[model samples]
Target: MKGNSLSQVYYRPIEAAIRWAGLLRFQHEIVAAIIDSRHLAVTLNCPRCDELRLYIDRIYDAIYHGELPYGQNGITIDDKSLWDSPDLTIRHVDLKRWMLNHYSGQRPAFLFSRGERIAHPVITLEAGNALLVEREALKSQLEQCRSQLRALQEQRKKHDQAPPACTLCPLSDRAEATYLHIIGAMLTLMLGRSPSGTPYSSFNSQEAIASALIAHHGHLMGITERTLQAKFAQARRKLQSAVS
Candidate 1:
């Protein structure tokens, strides 16, 4: 188990080989196998679940599914080398075990979830492979940003095409609802700024505001600014009277 490549036990380890208990051997062993980028990506970015549990689950799944396994030991890159040369790729990550002695907290899982360095490197290669973790984190962030952008754009589109509610005049019934809508559309489209974000220096005249309303929504409303001038003037006078 010396290289980066995954290995089977040369075959499956027998029950005795796997179960032997001694200072030199353990029932379960973690082989420093490379996990796929996709699985690691999900584990890193999962929002609701415990991050430590998420990381553990990913590693366990890889082992269970045989993506990574405890390969045979003392693998050499060169078959002819007389000296002891262990393959760096599949090497046992036992080199980094010293970090564990530093962790005395009872809730190490929680600490690991919070990304405490006292956590084991086996939880993920995240400690060593910063770029891989960062890539996944940034990709997830980018997707969220794109989603928010899409929602904002949709809201802006609807807002541009529609008018805000008219609170100035509350007609009791739809008996004259058409006038309410006209006023609303006028106020929405011409006051201060148009839906297109255009600033207007003056849109005080009923004729001018009505003309803009008609130009924008004439076909759908089936009404002309000429017919609305009287109603518009009546509303304007009411507003002026109230203010004065």
Candidate 2:
């Protein structure tokens, strides 16, 4: 009845097969690049779907001839639930061997379809291992971003007591209020955390959290590293002035 129970027992094998086939490699690469500088040097590319479609066609053929148990009408093997379930480990192993034996090389185009040129993209053993490593790194970065966002929210709450009165009391009083609000907004954007627990807010989404971490640390957020360093220097100067 539990969600994870089904995943471990029934869906894991299929999921592993899909992963090994490199279906989710792009997301893995993005996450890995965010977490480690070394990963940034690694080039990640998605396997062409046309190639995967050919494998699916072969699977259908095996099922049709009773070489494999499931078929096109049975349990839809391509569903994410089946792919992610742990129960499929043995199935995945068997499937991997089957794939390697029959689909590992650039097969003749005529065998796949009449009068069509097709290349079955083969993944070298080394590339498969690297993809697994990159996926783990991405999972790590997601966890780290979640923790960092939590800490920033706590800090914001502690600092939310009251705004200090403006020193220039007579001239442009609203300007100081606007400045403080702008600074608060920037901090929230940088931290990607919401204190109000709103469901639809950008801070709650995976993409927002991922983007913020990538921007701040991954060197992919458009701003140059030099700009970030300069901002850090300016922040330190402002802090020192406040203390003095």
Candidate 3:
């Protein structure tokens, strides 16, 4: 009377061993308790019922017909004392083997339903070699994508903070021309000129343009007056082309 009930002895202990070995990480339980001692078939909670069936078949084969005896104490299935004996335990080595075969590798049988009936060995070891490979590969790809995203974000931030460049002259191709366009727009607005030749005094226009240009492009500040005059004329022509 010190043992589990007949219902518990038959499959519950084995199910617990399977769970202890970490084979049932995603499933809630093996299955609802449906044990038929006559035919000895128990439905499992796994999606592939056939796979479960085959797995159970291997367990039965090992216990009832295979080389290994039932448990550590050499308890046979016919022993009535085993029915209620809570001390009943499968040997650790056997249990380890059972965990490995069922869950570990890409068993040829699991490739398709057609091979489900092809019973092979079942071992339980919670092997994570395959999962570790996939996890590392995914982690590498995710890090690479994150690095690319960060680079794009940095470039966008720099572009947003900088002043706009003219599309026609494009600061990349002609920084001087682009600067001239900006200086001309500032001067035209200040001179009260409405896109017409009826501008304010040309002297004030030139002086303000020079001041604004020097403030922005400080390299022009040290140039001689004659050279400055020539650069101003060139800037005016470039500004006209940009506006047109």
**Which candidate has the top score in lDDT?**
3
Q: Is candidate 1 or candidate 3 better by TM-score?
A: 3
**lDDT by residue for model 2 (74-123), tens:** 23354333322323222433444454566655323212232332344546
Give per-residue lDDT, candidate 1, residue 173.
58
- Candidate 3 lDDT, tens digit per residue, 1-244? 1122221222334453333333444323543333532122344544555555555555555555443335424344544344344444454345445545554443322122334324543333443565455556645654564465355435535655565563243446565565566445444444543322333333356666556545654443233455555766776677788768
Candidates in descending TM-score order: 3, 2, 1
- Please, what are the lDDT tens digits per residue for candidate 1 over residues 1-244? 2222222222122211121111112112222121332122333332322433343443334434444333324242322231122221222231112113322222222113335434533433554386555556545654564465356435535645565563354546553453344444344334444333444325655567568657865663334766667666655555455446
Candidate 2 backbone overlaps, count: 13
Q: What is the clash tally of candidate 1? A: 6
Model 2 residue 38 CA deviation in Å: 47
TM-score of each: 0.21, 0.25, 0.26
lDDT of 3: 0.45
For model 1, the local distance difference test gives 0.37
The TM-score of predicted model 2 comes to 0.25
| Maximum-TM-score candidate | 3
